[model samples]
Target: MGINTTKLKRGFRELFGKTVQAFIVQLRMETGLMLIENTDLSISEIVYRVEYSYPASFTQAIRNHYGKTPQALRCLA
Candidate 1:
């Protein structure tokens, strides 16, 4: 899929109170989806691409957003 720059930008503007937080949230969401779709790479590798502070943070965010663990999602796919 392509980047929905306009929609994403507008989403950030509305959903995030701050620009930086919005950017990071968007980064995390986008990267999380990439991680879900592509199983070739490890979660640790994907964590960095998403700019997560640590693996735990990435996993926590994934869990919070999807209501499923990364491993669970991977297995389902």
Candidate 2:
């Protein structure tokens, strides 16, 4: 196939207004929010399930993208 990682990532960002990684993270956040709102999964569990390599990084990404930590978001929900 002609699609390389760089081109694919660029196309994803062009089409979605976020890099592929960011978009995936966004999706994970959305779902995580839903889970937080509706389910009983612990924060750490959600972090791991979201595919972040570590809880700290996931918390950082959540803060960076949503302007809130996962715990804060859960509190808000």
Candidate 3:
């Protein structure tokens, strides 16, 4: 799609009330949560599955977004 950056950002914010980066991280965290719930994948595995670079970064993102680490979330399962 020939998305113009200014328009795309504006449209995304209008539609979702969030920036693109926020939307992407939300998607990553949701997939990470589902993987934690349903799969026996390791934290690192889940991180990479969501296209995250490292375990700590993934951990921090999960913590920031959901207020729990991947391990802690898995423990809920």
Q: Compare the candidates by lDDT and give the number of the best one.
A: 3
Candidate 3 lDDT tens digits, 1-77: 79888998999899999999989988998999999999998888888899989899999988998898888899999
How do all models score by TM-score? 0.65, 0.73, 0.90
* lDDT against the true structure, each candidate: 0.76, 0.82, 0.91
lDDT tens readout by residue for model 2, 1-77:
78898898888888999987777878988887777677779878888787777889878877887899888888887
Model 1 stretches with alpha carbons more than 4 Å out:
1-20
Stretches of candidate 3 off by over 4 Å are: 1-3
What lDDT is reached at residue 41 by model 2?
Answer: 93
Candidate 2: which pairs clash? none
TM-score-wise, the better of 1 and 2 is: 2
Q: Cα RMSD to native, each candidate?
A: 7.6, 2.0, 1.4
| Number of backbone-clashing residue pairs for each candidate, in the order shown | 0, 0, 0
Total clashes, candidate 2?
0
TM-score leader: 3
Error of 3 at 56 (Å): 0.5
lDDT of 1 by residue, 18-73 (tens): 57565778678777777767756787788887788798988888888888877777
